[model samples]
Target: MTEFVLVPGLFTGQAVWRDTAGKLAAEGARVQVVDVGPVRDLEAHIARVVAAIDTIAEGQDIVLVGHDYGVYPAVGAADRRAHRVARIVYLDTGPVQDGAVALAAVPDQELRERLAEDGDMKGELPVPSREEWSRWGSTAGVSGEALDRLTAHASPQPLGTLLRPLRLTGAGDGLPTTGVLCAESGATIDTVRMLLRFGDPTMKALVRPDVTFFELPTGHWPMLSCPDELADVLLRAAAGEGTRLEAVGEEEAGEEEAGESGYLRPFLLDVPEIPRERRGAIDLYVPEGGHVSEGTESGEPRPAIVFVHGGPVPEDARPTPRDWPTLIGYARLAASRGAIGVTLDHRLHAVTAYPTAAEDVAAAVAEVRADPRVDADRIALWFFSGGGPLTAPWLAEAPPWLRCLAASYPIMAPLPNWGVNDSRFRPADVVAHGGTPPFVLIRVGREAPAVATTVAEFVGAAEAGGAPVEVIDVPGAPHAFEGLDHSDAARDAVGEAMGRVLGRLGLE
Candidate 1:
């Protein structure tokens, strides 16, 4: 029988894995919960885990399961016993980079310093209060009775574990690895992966080509909140099965091919030397089997849609530019309909607002148009939310190659709170310049009163200016409705908007 070794995260004991272990045991597999006693440092933790792994029967298949901070020690143990390890399953955490001081820096420095100054519990970090636990633990789907159990079992983490540096060799490089990502923290994980890809050689090992990634729709602690589902994921990881747990209503009869989803298959494109010391990048979602134009002239390239994501937030809001998951879903929708979909990151707000964002959009458009695979003359611009204002310049003097513009519940007017002061930031004013491209405005009928009012005013102004504008209202949907609800109304609204865009461009 295969042996499964379970490791708990920081400030926790073997009890955290009990629920998951019970489920695994019911599958007729041997489950061993390694108690990483009194966390002192990374070295001590690794020693304890290695000792547990050593106790397993000789020559039996061993799988090391690590959650959160426990991943480091688990990886270290796997490295030492590569010959005996079959797979390394990472739960809501990825492998640590070599020579890294900690998985991540503690956010509250004052609290960290205070804990160190107190020297309480012989230097162990204090167990957080009930409120603190609830605030931080809520995201992991822990609540009510579960929250009480978690707090009752909570222990002070060893400061050394967070302070110690880590090092790794290629000893376990050949081992099969699986990453079970928590859905709520998916964006954070993507940001981490982006950082790893740009630099940081040590962390790059966590993103091996052979590693199968799956996203579980839960918070950080799947064992506590979703034990059965977590057990199923672990089983599939061991057997080398599915990459993702099907979302609601996504269950189909047949198995889906690896990396093949109904959405766009993303490929990264870097935008270098952007203004204000900022860097830009894009995720291009190309159609499956390539862009094959239908009913178009022979040898002509397929139409393309450039998607500008919303956000003009403070530069330090996130480590990198935010890529909207909703925009990616739309891009996939575009690709499935045989159009090249491009989602780009531009200069953020505060640092370089207004004209700078417009400049970035122009640069992105130029880049896309230059691509030989795209039909430059048949292109559209899609601006969502905060990105609405950036489309002002395009509407004012749209290039001949630009066929139309599409905005979804966009911020057409400026927000003084965000320091948007320039007159050009208003979409209505820009459309007054005339010669505007055909526009398709998607409004959420049940949107905030202010947003609905702004969209209505803009529509009136655009029509008055003799601009060929079409407004499609998705009744009873809120802002970013596509993400909020995937009802038939949402799908149909999106489809109708795309249909209008393609029809205007003569691609339909």
Candidate 2:
């Protein structure tokens, strides 16, 4: 049976499931991180979770679990799809509120708003206050690093959801409750306070009879706190072993499937240098059927190269983020060859900014080498346009994760103002977000001051420091000409260019 559907609250993404889902998986319960959106709000974000619940619970009992402000989406989803929903578990979340009372939660100077009737998070105004940053707010517990992620990628929500009335249909009729409260160090207390502070009259009017209240002695995010305990609770509910767990499913183990990978053998690598504290991560995106047999050379894991896609990405999708290059044909080419290619996100300013992007590359290389599916010493880092930052800092510091590195028309110099994700701010967000890879560089770009100067300076520093680095100007190539998805030459060249770097590193 499916264990539970856990939805992260505002400003959170699938990474929130990183720990919780890992725990649940160890226990034999099918756990999935409902993909909402890069943005945090109702309609778009909440609706995704609801739809996941509905799809999974069709004619079955479900324990709709939500954290913090995620309660509204959980409840709304359950209410709209009553026949399939069995119970809604609120993990340190507020109960459904209706009308102006819900709007009252928004502390506005001259006006008030609410999603009481419609149970919308996007539509409502949280009101500019420290509460949004304090423990009283849903996002209070996030680490500076995690919060930085939000600032880097989080989008603003719409206001309609806040004003909509939460009209419950028949779906929520028999929905039971399970409150996973976070109490340790006062986090749970604030959770409870917020529950009373924002819950609907119906929820606050009476202590829920069906609720199986439990508290964790941890911070706000239990997924990061007691993953094991949280998993057990979810399993109990999914298996109907708890006081309020939903009915068990008939399906047997492995009968359920996981979300298809964007590859056959996807990989995530995290590497960090001194004082960095090691949160940098990289992923080898694979589409279904992307890989075949392992490398033919005895037990070889096949040659791998970091595939750095070009330029500043859309607001919805950053340049080096997982979703950005997905639209381009870059990653697809690597997967087709049975090559374990890596795509990373790193920071660059004006672009993604400086140090933030550099940190990601440095960290990503360390991680890529550790992957069991990858040849530790055979990996190569590839880049194009503004891809200079990937290797510049790594070359400068040479924190020891590379076998080789490559670049093309990189906007090599450090940007003036990266703002929140500045080199002065944080660097990890950029490198991987911008496609950080491991190994020596294949630098390419116009020989103009815009590109040549920074690349030359960085490599000269690395080579002088005894780092293994190389550069190649693209003659007359424009800034990002060689990596454009629209050009077959760019497509063909990316792999061949990467192949040359790998060949030099003795991975061919």
Candidate 3:
């Protein structure tokens, strides 16, 4: 019989893996949940996993499973016992490289400081509170009784485990490996590969050319939220089935075909005016089944909204169907809520300045309008962050076909710091334009004070000019709060904003 060894992530013992182990055993595989007792350092944890593998009956096939912080030791043990391990599976995490620390520090500076202050007391990092869990942890799809159990078993994690770096000698390079990613985290296996291809240190050591990748649509804690599904994935990984290696370029196409919801489609928009190297593409999100007409006596095609993603930086501006999870989530939400969603990529600041991005947006709108499935006469424009400036022309001389314009934490005026010239990129200059369209602006009140000040000034100007504009304020939320923190406030803010836009378009 094949034996599977399981290692829990930070802040818990073997209890975290109990559900998964039970399910795996029910499926006829022998399972062992290793206890990483008193994780003093990397070496100590690895020893525990290695010891578990040793106890397995001789000549039996062995599969090793690791989750989050546990991935470091699991990979270490796989390296030390390569000849004995058959396959290694990683859940919601990747391997830590030889020279790199497991985690340098928490991503949020505020959270890191709090953890440091709290660590001084008990020498361990406390689990986040219920509010914090709602923003981050509660994504696992567990609720009611399951949630109660999760809260009861949660424990503090050791600081030593997080501080130490893993040491590897390439011993596990050829070991058969598989990675299961949490979709809510905005990461997919292909996205991980793309990050690794670009030389991301944290991902470089985890993914290899031969590694098979699968994605789970749940939150970080799959064991607690969806153990049966997690167990099934583990079975497939152990059997060496369910996924196959494909070239990076081909993965996106495959995802579209196998997309969770059948509403996603990709299109390449040509920008002959710009160099081919800088031309960008767009992704269309429509109702599942197919794009069908609505809102007319004869049921004419559905209205479309061109989505412009934020970013003046080259890295942030470039578009891929998989990257920008929040944008994709917004697009998916729009499609599900009865609007044809169009998201496009534009040239970055590195390629050219202001007008280039504007031109790309125009081209994308034209392409989307030309589609037979879209009602060109009822089009709208939604801009995010830096993409807001491109709305100047539309605001100054609104096209008769344009119904409305919406912005999220938009930069209404040119900032000298961003090298934006006041004369060309200013939205205030067009506030007096006679043909300005109705507008909706969503702002996070707790964002940079300068942003709030600029938006307030623009709202005042638009009101004075008699241009209809609606402002939705989400207090105590920071910029990009929807993606940074998946709090209920964030979801409601996005839904409310989209609802207002849809109503203006006569689609609601």
Candidate 4:
């Protein structure tokens, strides 16, 4: 109903939106690219965007498209001017995350983080020189000269813009949203797949009938590679067209059904309620395509990688949006070697309390272990963030029936002390069953290092107790690592780590 306006992410300005804007306008859609930069804070940044959109809108419904960091301002703009804003076209940029989902979802979603972590008053980060930008886009026809011009013309973005939490209360309420993605940018793609992994509260909240979806074959900067296509997607969505995929299950698509791919077998389970716990369930993601291995003479199946995604969206309940990153972790990365990967929804939310989450994990392992194709003895635990408190103890005191164990950033130590995420602490039963499997811990520096710290503490305690342990650390990564969705390096590293762990556990 309202016209269409776009908000730019960090480092760039409305200049980047030129191509896309033209295409949308050519289609008879009223389009405006708000240059809310050269501001001091996110609040100010948003106000500027709103002021510009208000001027262009002049009293009409407006569809909004946000690219990268632009997502934050878009939310602010929508929130501030909800009546004039109709729908949103989220390009490459995923959803506006909740107040710092513990792991911070950095590095992978680096553009925004880097801007926030390393921004100047001029709205510049340690950007790859104009030459670098051109080289990256050269294959797609982007030139350094164009990039230089854009960068020079772009105004500085403030730090608070990236750090501020989004408040979409009255603004985003009842607004139809369209998530348009670019498949080529590794980070952007990873963000979509790893929606749960990277702590994307925005996508979780928008999964209802209100939000439509679309995918493009461009990189994070679609205005550069697939401008025409991106514009087309936004216009159609603005004019009221959405994807058929959204029509599937309205209410409970269930965690397992989220992000269901060819290599993944996601299924929901009505789990048993344990003492000290309320209603609970288990979501599982196991490598599916390959034949169930005919066990050795002992009649045992291959072990599995029990994965606990980062605690970003408490209501995610399943892997739908979360499994975007699993494409690499489950299908292309780990499964090819003959392994089983499982993702579970623990009692991470207050609404989904303690013993309940622990029970989900136990039941998931029990269920997956029962599978004839799996080698139950080689089972390993792979956890993202807050996933630790439940995982660490389970690794220490797993059932005798289980085998090897592994976890990354398993949160089991002191909170409020490590500058980590302890704000959304949901109570849970921590089972420290002794006599667990050989432990393998993989830590990519930036993503939840708590688990790594836990691993170190455990290693120290084990040393005193004479126990063996392994730890791997990745550099220049964030709390969510590649699972966070922006850094190709993090994605590739974590995928490799998962594969290596699975191989060692003999899941391979």
- How accurate locally, in lDDT, is each candidate? 0.67, 0.48, 0.67, 0.54
Clashes of each: 3, 55, 0, 43
Residue 180's lDDT within candidate 1 is 84
Q: Least accurate stretch of 10 residues (summed lDDT) in model 2?
A: 268-277
Worst 10 residues of 1 by lDDT: 269-278
- Ranking, lDDT, top scorer first: 1, 3, 4, 2
Decoy 1 TM-score against native = 0.53
Ranking 1 against 4 by lDDT, winner = 1
Model 3 residue 25 CA deviation (Å) reads 0.7
All candidates' TM-scores?
0.53, 0.38, 0.54, 0.50
Error in Å for residue 428 of model 4: 38
Model 2 spans with C-alpha error above 4 angstroms: 38-46, 57-60, 97-153, 184-209, 237-508
State model 2's lDDT: 0.48
lDDT of 1 by residue, 298-390 (tens): 346778888886654444434333244456666766766677777777775531366788887888888888878688888999897668878
Q: Which stretches of candidate 1 lie over 4 Å from their true place?
A: 105-122, 134-140, 187-210, 244-508
Model 3: per-residue Cα lDDT over 333-377, one tens digit each: 666655677877776443125688888888989988887767888
Better of 1 and 4 by TM-score: 1
Residue 433 lDDT (model 2): 35
